[model samples]
Target chain A: MTLYASSKAALRVYSESLAQELSSQFPGIRVIIVEPSGFRTEQNVLGYPMQIPRNPDPAYDSVREKSMQLYTSLDGRQRGDPEKAVELIVDIVRREGKSVERLGGGRAESPIYVPLGREANNDLEAKCTKMIQVVQKWKDVTDNLDHDDTNSVDLTRWGALRFFFLGSLHAYRAFQDRIRALASAGF
Target chain B: MTLYASSKAALRVYSESLAQELSSQFPGIRVIIVEPSGFRTEQNVLGYPMQIPRNPDPAYDSVREKSMQLYTSLDGRQRGDPEKAVELIVDIVRREGKSVERLGGGRAESPIYVPLGREANNDLEAKCTKMIQVVQKWKDVTDNLDHDDTNSVDLTRWGALRFFFLGSLHAYRAFQDRIRALASAGF
Candidate 1:
C-alpha cells in the first residue's frame, strides 16, 4: 500500500510539473489529471481474490486480513459506472455536452484535475485539508528553522560572491541588495 | 530536474508512512528526515562541470546555458559549513548540547524533520504557503465535486452491501449513518 500510494503521488506531482512546464511554450496543450474512484471494472469486481501469502509476516496479519476482507466484499459492488465515466471523459476532452458548460464554453481554462466520483472528490479534498492543517500546526517551528545569523553582516565574502556569480537572476538581485545594505552600514 | 524533484517527493512520503507504520510497534525507533541546503561538500563546490550535450536541442538551449552558468559560478562558494552541519546532526541524534534544550531536556519528542539551513527553511516555508494558497483557491471546486445524487435513495443495494461487508471500520460507520438516514426518510 505504501509503495502504491507513493508511486501515485509521484505520478501526480510529475503530471503537475509537466502541465506547468508546457503551459508557457504550448498554450494549446492541456494536461488533465483524471482521478477515478472505484469504477465497476472487471478488475475491481472479480479480479481480487483472497489469497493468503505463503510467507506472510505475523506483524502484518491483522492488516492483511482486513484488506483481504475489504477487497473481496467490495468486488462487483463499486458504485461508479465505467461506461458513464468513459462518456464523461470523452466529452471533457472533446468539449461537448454538459462538459462544455462546465468548462465555460471554451473561454475559460480547463481545470488541471478532474476527480470523477464522489469518493475521489472527497478523498482529494480530505488530503488537501489535512495537509493544510498539518502545515499550519507546524508553521511556527518550520518558519523558525533558519540559522540565527542568516541576515547578519558577518556573512562570508565567499557566500556573497557565490550568489553574485552563480545564482539565478533572483538570487543575483538579492545579493545586490545585501551588498547595498552592507555598504550603507559602513561594512 | 522534474524527475529528481518528483522522486525526492515520493521518497519523502514513503519515509513518512514508514515512520507512522513503525511508530506503534517500535516505540524506541526514530525516523528523522534531514533536508540540507547547499552544504560546502565536494559535490556542491567542484563536482559539477559545465558540459554541453553532444546532441543538444535548440528548444532547451536557453535553460541549459542558464543552469550551466549558475552551477559554474556557485562552485566552491556555497555558504553552508559541512562540518557544522555534521556536528548539528550528530548532536540532534545524540540529544546533546543545545539540542537538549531545543528538544525539551530529552522529555519531548524529537522533530521528525530537521531542515539544515536558512535556504532550506525559507524554501520549505514557501512551498507550504504556496500549497495552502492553491488549495484555498480551489476549495469551492474541490468541495463541490461529489456526484449530485450521492445521498439519493437510488444508491444500489450492492453499493451498501459492499460498504457493510468489506469496508474499513470508518467506512462501516459512515455506511451505518447513511442507512439510518435512509430509514428515517421512509426508504
Candidate 2:
C-alpha cells in the first residue's frame, strides 16, 4: 500500500498535467478525469492481500505491512459500487461533451474531475488541504533550495488523492473492461 | 515547477508500473527509471563549497551522509547537465515513439524520473519530516506496526513515497544516446 499510494498520487498529478497540456495544445479532444473512490469490485474478491510483494528486511518498518493487511480486510466490503460508478461516468461523458463552435459558442463547464462518491469527495478535500499544509509547513526549506535568483518555489498539490484511498489499482484494473464497456455504450 | 514536480512523481509511479509490466508482459520494450538527485550544477557552482559523495564515513551523521552525501556528490561530477536533459530526451524519442497511438496511449505517461537537483521537493520533505520529528521526537517507536482499527488512522500518507525515491534501474545503458551537440548550448 505504501508504494501503491505514491504510485496513485503520481497518477493523479500526471492526469492533471496531461489535462492541462492536452487542453491547451489540441482542441476538440476533451479529457474527463473520472476520479472514483472505493468500490466493492473483483479485486477485493481476487487480487490483494497475497499479491503485493513484501519487503523482506526485518529492519523495514512494519506499518506498511499492517496497512496492507488492513486494506485487505476491507475487501469486498467497500462502500461505492463499481457498476454505479461506470454508469455515472457513461452518463456524464454522454452529457458532458458538447460541440461549442457549432452551438453559437455556448459551452458548459465540463466536469473535469468526476469524483464518484461521498467518501471520495471527502478524501480529495483532505489530501488537497494536507498537501498544502505540508508545503506551507516546509515552505522555508523548500524555498531555500532553488537558485538564489529564482523567485518561485515548486509545490505540487495533488487534487485527486481521495479517489485512490482504497489502494485498488488492481481492483480498477480488474474493472477497467466493465467501465470501458459502459463508456462505449453511446459515450 | 509544481507541475514538473508532480509530473516526475507521476512518472516515477508510471515507470515502476511500466517496468513491471514490460518485464512481465511485453518482454521487448524494457522500461527504466533514472532517479538522480543533486549535483554541482551552475547553482552548486556557488553553493556547497565541498560537494558531497565524500563523507569518507566520518564526523558527519550517517543519516545526513546517507541522504545528502550519497546524493550530493556522485562518484564523479554528474555527467548529465541541464542541457543534456534536452538532448538526451530527443535522442530517446527519435527512437522511442513508434506509431501515433500504438507507441502507446497506454503510454499515457512514462516515468523516466530524472530527479535533478538536491532539492527533490517531496523526497526532501519526507526525509526532513521523518528525520527531524520522527527521529528526534518519535525515535522511540516509529517502527511499530498497528492493527487496532481505530477509525482515524487514515493510512495512505505514504502511498507515494518509495517508487519515487529508490529511483534506479540499470536499463538505460542499453541506449546511452550518442548526443553531445545540445549539451553545450550555453546551458
Candidate 3:
C-alpha cells in the first residue's frame, strides 16, 4: 500500500509539472490529469485473499495488523464503476480532440483535471480543502521567518499592503467559490 | 528544460518515498538523495554553446528568447563545489555506517536527503516557503467548498479542534524551519 500510494503521488506531481511545461510551448496540446478511483476492472476483481503479514518488529505490529485487515476486507469490494468512468473520459477527450486542429487551428480549453469517480472526486476535494486549511491555520508561524535585514517595518505601508492583500484574497475567494460550485454540480 | 525539470522532480519524489519505505522494511538499507546543484561536473563543461531558438510564434517569442538566453549563459559557469560536496556526503555516510550494527548488522538511517550545493539549497528553501505561502493565502477560499450536510457548526468542539490543529501546525512549522535553517547552515 505504501509503495502504491507513493507511485500515485509521484505521478500526480509529475503530471502537474508536465501540464505547466506544456502550457506555454504548446498551448493547444494539454496533458489532462485524470484521477481515477478504484473501478470494478479485471485487475481489481480479486481472485483470492491477499497475504499481509504484520511487521516482524514488535513495535510496528499494531499498524501492520490494522492495515492488513483493512486491505483484506477491500478485495473484490470496491464500488467504483470503471466502464462508466471510461466512457466519460472518452467523451471528454473526444471533445478536447477538437483542439488538435487549433494549433494552426489549435488551442482549446479542456478541463485541466478530471476526477473519475464519486469517491475519487470526494477524496480529492477533501484533500485539497484540508491542505488549504492547513496552510491557513499556520500562516502566522511561517510568515515571519525571514531575517529582518531592513531593520524596520514600514508602518505607513500597512494601508497599502492590506489593500493589496485584500484585493488578491478576494480574487482567490472567487476562484475557490467556482471550484466548489463546479464540484457540487457534479463536474 | 521542461523535460529535465520534470524528470528531476519525479525522481526527487520517488527517492524520498523509497527512503521512507526502506527505513521501516529494511533497517539496514539506506538510500541517500543527493541534491547536486550544477557541480563543475565533466558533462557540464559544455563542449559547445547550446542552441536555443526563440519560439516561431510571435506570441511566445519573448519568453522563449529570455529562457534561451539564460540557459545558454549557464553552460559551464556553475559555482557549486562538487568535490567538497562529495567529500561531505562520504563523511556523512561513514558516520551512519556505524549505525548498521543497531540493526544487527542490518540497516542504517537512510541519509534522509542531502542537498549537494549552495544553489540546490537556495532553490529548495525558496520553493518550500512559496508553497506554504500559496496554501496559506488561499485557505479561506478552499475551506468552504463542501456543502454543510449538518449545519450545527459544533462550536463546542472548536477548543479541542484548535488545540489539535495548532499542535499539528506547530510540528509542520518546526519541520519547515529546520529545513531552511539547515539549508542556510550549508547542509
Candidate 4:
C-alpha cells in the first residue's frame, strides 16, 4: 500500500501508523509512507485562507503584518522545483507497488542552522528517499518474520491509531519548541 | 502543483479549498487530486485505536463484534485490489506532486454486503471512498465564490475562525448522517 500526504506534520502521523499497522497484518505486503515537505501547492498557499480571529489591535498590527509577510513570502518559493517533485512521485508509484515507506524533502537538514534552500530544497525528493528507506526496513523485518509464527504476532487493537497520535504529539511538541524559541528571542 | 491524499475524501477537501484559494495566486501551476481505493497494508488491518470517549461497556460488546466481523469480511475482495490501490496512489503522487488528493476504502454503501475476496472489501475502504467523494463535492461548493465575492475571500478579521467553525458544522452534519445510518441498523 502506498500513501501520499501533503502536510509533513499531519501526514507523518497518519502514514507512520498506517505503515506499522499494515506491516503487522499482511506480513509480506509493501507499505510506503511518503511525506513531502512544504511544496508550492495550494494547500501551502491557498488551500485555506489565513483567517485572523479578530481585528488586530493597532498594538499587534506589526506582529500580524510580520506573520503575514512570513507566510506570503512563501508564495511560490516554499516548495521545491515542482517538476522534480512530480518526477519523484511518479517513480515511487511505478515501482512494484511494494511495501515501501518514503519521505520527500526538498533539501538537506542542518542541526545547528537552517539549510540554504530552507524548507524548499528538494523537499519532495528527500521525503521520497526516506520513504524508500522505511519500506526497505519494513520489508527486511517482515521477510525475517516468516521464520516466526504469525500466531505470535499479537496485533495491537489500534496500533496504527496510537502511532498516528504519537506523531501528532511529536509535531505538537515541535510547534511548542518553535513557539518557545520565538518567545525566548523576544525576552 | 500536484497533490496526493491518502483517501479520495481527504483529497476532495484538500484539492477543493486549496485549488480554490491558490487558483488566483498561481495561474500556471496545475493542481491534481487522486482518489485511490482500499488496500491491505499493515495499518489497514489495525490503525491507532481511537481514544474511546468513555469506558468500554459489556453492553456494546455485541455491537462492536458485529462491526468487526463486517469489517474483516472485506479484506481481499471487491472493495479494492491492494496492488491497484498503490499503483493509483503512486501515479497521482507523481503526476500531482505539487498538489495531490487520495483515499482508501473498505466498507461498501451497506455494511451487510460481503464480496468474495473478502480481505479487500472491508468497511473502512468503503467508508473512506464515500468520505472522499462527499468531501470533494462539499469543498468544491463551499469554495465557490460566485454567489458573493465580498464575503468569499476576506480573511482579515476573525474570518479564519469563522470559516473553520462553519466547516466544522458541515463535518458535524456528515458525522450525523453516519450516526443516523448506524442507528437505523439497530446499533
Candidate 5:
C-alpha cells in the first residue's frame, strides 16, 4: 500500500503507523508513504493562514489577506500540477503493477531547525530509514511467534495509541514550527 | 494511507475508497492498496474449522486433521521473510515516492491475469483490480462536491450481525478454497 503525504510535518506519522499495521496483518503487501511539498488545494495553501474563521486579530489580518491573494492568483498550479498529480498516482500503479497502497498527504522533509520549505529531504529520508530499521528488528524477534497468541491489545506496543499520539504530536509541532517560519519569512 | 488487506478481496475495496477520499481532501497525498498472497503464519492457519460437535459430515475429521497439520508445520523458515517483505515495501516507497496505488508482490510483467497460488494470491489481486476500477470510475462521476461523503470508514462498514454473517462467511469460503488448493498441491 502506498500513501502520499503532502507535509511530513502534518500527517506523516499517522500514515506511517497505519501502513505498518496493514503490512503486519496482510502478507505479500507493501505500504508506500509519499511526502510531497505543499500543493495549492481547496482546503490548504502554502504559506497562507486559513481564511475559514478565527478570532478577530487585526494585527494578522493584513498578512492573511495577502496570503489569500497569492494563493488565489496561482489558480491550481501552486505546488505542482493537479493533472500531474493524478498521473503520478497512476504511474505508481503501473510501476508497482499488482500490489497497491491507498493514498494521502504529508511533508517530504524535516521541520526541525529550518524555516518553512527549507528542511532538507534527506533528513526526512533518514527518519524513514530509522523507522523501517526498527520495524525490521522487531519483526525479527516476533516473526516466528503467533501474533494472535499475544493478541491482547497493548497501548504501549509499537502499534498503540500512545505511540500514535506522541508521534503525531511531534509531527504537529514540527509543522507548527514550519508555519511559524513561514510567517516570520513574511508570508 | 495504504492498507494491507487481510483478505485481499474485501480489504482491497476498503483501501481503494479510502485512497479516493484522502486524495480529494488532501491532494498531494497518495494511497496505495497492496493485495497479498498468503504467508505461512499462525494467523493464516489458526482456528480454521468450527464444528458444532454434533455435526454429521464424514469429511469433517479429515478436514480438521489437515488444518491442524498446516498450522503445526508453519513455524519458522517456511514463513515468508519479514525483511524481504519490508525491502519490497521500501522499494516501492522509493520508486513511487509520493504517488498513490503501488502494488507489491513477487512477480514479473504486469499481467491482466496473474497465476494463482495455493493461497489464492491471484484471486485476491483480480478481485482488488475489479473493486478499484469500479470505485475509481464511480468517484469520477460522484465527487460529491456538496454533502458529507459516506464512503470510507476506519473499521468495517457493516454492522455486527451482517458483518458476522456475510463478511465472515466470505472469508471462510476463501480459507476453505486455500486449504483445498494447498492439499491438492501436496503441501
Candidate 6:
C-alpha cells in the first residue's frame, strides 16, 4: 500500500507540472489528471486471495493477516461505478453534453484535475487541511535557520524561469512538428 | 528537475508514513526529516561547467543554455551556512545545547520535521497554501462523483487501523528480540 500510494502521489505531482508546462504556449494541449476511488472491477474483486510470501518475517505476520482479511471483505463492496466514471471523463475531454458547462464552455479556464468520487474528494481535502495546519504550527522553527545574508540571489525565481523557458521551447518544437506534418499532407 | 523534484516529493510522503507507523509502538524510534535549502558546499561552488550531453535535442537548446548560465551565476553565492545547519540538527537530535528549550525539554512532543532555512520554509508554506486554495476551488466537482451508497464501509478508516495494528506487531517483535539478546548476554 505504501508503494502504491507513493507512486500515485508522484504521478499527481508530475501531472501538475506537465499541465503547468504546457498551458502557456500550447493552449490547445491539455494534461488532465484523474483521481479515482476504487471501483468494483474484475481485478479488485477476483484478483485477491493472493499467494502469501513463503518466508514472510514474523514481525509482519499480524499486518499481513489483517490486510488479507480486509481485502477479502472489501472485494465486491467498492462504491464506484466505472461506466459512469468513464462516460464523464469522455464528456469532459470532448466538451460535450453536461460536462460542457461544467468544464467552463469555451471561455473560462478548464480544470486540470478531475477527482472522481466522494472518497477522493474527502481524502484530498483532509490531507490539504492537515498539511496547512502542520506548516503553520512549525512556522517559527522553520524561519530561524537562515545565514543572515539578505543579499543572495533568489534561486527559486531563477529555477521557475528556467522551467518556463524549457516548456516554451518544447511547445515550439511540437508546433513545428505539427506544421511540418500538415504541410506534407498537402494542407 | 522534474524527475528530481518528483522523487523528493515521493520520499517526503514515504517518510511521513514511516514516522506515523513507528511512533505508536516504538516510542524510542523517531524518524526526522531534514529539509535543507541550497548551501555553499564544495559541490555547489566547484561542480559547475558540467559536461554537456553529446546528442542533446535541439528542442531543449534554449532551456539548456539558460540553466547552465543560471548555475554558473549562482556558484559560490548560496545564502545557507552548512555548519550551522548541521550543528542545529545534532542539537535537536541529542536534545542538548540551546535546542533543549527549543525542542520543549523532554516534556512536549518532538518535531518530526526540520526545515533548515528561510527558503525551505517559504517554499513549503507557499506550496501548502496553494494546495488548499486549489482544493477549495474544485470542491464542487470533487463532491459530485459519489455512487450514492451512504451505507458503504469507510475503507480509509479500516486502512488506518490495519497500519496501526501492523506497527504494534512490529514493535512487539523488536521488543522480544531485544529481551532475548539481553538474556543470552547475561544482562
Fraction of native contacts, model 6: 0.32
Pairs that collide in candidate 2 are A5-B159, A5-B160, A6-B159, A6-B160, B11-B111, B38-B117, B104-B107
TM-score of each: 0.61, 0.37, 0.43, 0.26, 0.26, 0.73
- How big a share of the true inter-chain contacts is recovered in candidate 1? 0.11
Candidates' DockQ values? 0.12, 0.04, 0.03, 0.02, 0.02, 0.15
Clashes of each: 1, 7, 8, 84, 40, 0
Flag the better candidate by DockQ, 4 or 6: 6
lDDT of each residue in B70-178, candidate 3, tens digit only: 4344333334433444444445556544223322334344544554333334444554554444334323322222223333222123222111211222223333454
Candidate 6 residues A2-93, lDDT tens each?
Answer: 55455656776777666655665566788777676654443432244544453355766765677677656655565555556665666777
Off by over 4 Å in 5: A1-187, B1-8, B40-59, B77-79, B96-121, B124-187
Off by over 4 Å in 1: A36-42, A50-56, A76-111, A114-187, B45-56, B79-88, B95-111, B116-119, B122-187
RMSD of each: 12.0, 24.3, 19.5, 21.8, 22.6, 17.0
Which residue pairs does candidate 6 place in steric collision?
Answer: none
Tens-place lDDT per residue, model 1, B64-135, is 676566566555555555545555555767777645655554434422666555555545555555544544
- Candidate 4 lDDT over residue span A18-133, tens digit each: 54444545444444432222333333332355533344456546545654654455443332233333333334444312102221233211111111111212232343344344
* Candidate 4 positional error at B35, Å: 37
Given the true complex, what DockQ would model 5 score? Answer: 0.02
Q: Is candidate 3 or candidate 5 better by lDDT?
A: 3
Reference-based lDDT, each prediction: 0.51, 0.38, 0.42, 0.32, 0.32, 0.56
The CAPRI quality class of candidate 4 comes to: incorrect
Judging by TM-score, tell me the better candidate of 3 and 5: 3
Arrange candidates, best lDDT first: 6, 1, 3, 2, 5, 4
Question: Quality of candidate 2's docking, in CAPRI categories?
Answer: incorrect
**lDDT (tens digit, per residue) of candidate 5 on B32-89:** 4332222332222223332223338564555355434433443321323333333344
Q: Label model 6 with its docking quality class.
A: incorrect
Model 1 clash pairs are A45-A76
Fraction of true contacts kept, per model? 0.11, 0.05, 0.02, 0.00, 0.00, 0.32
| Candidates by DockQ, descending order | 6, 1, 2, 3, 4, 5
Candidate 6 residue B97 Cα shift, in angstroms, is 5.9
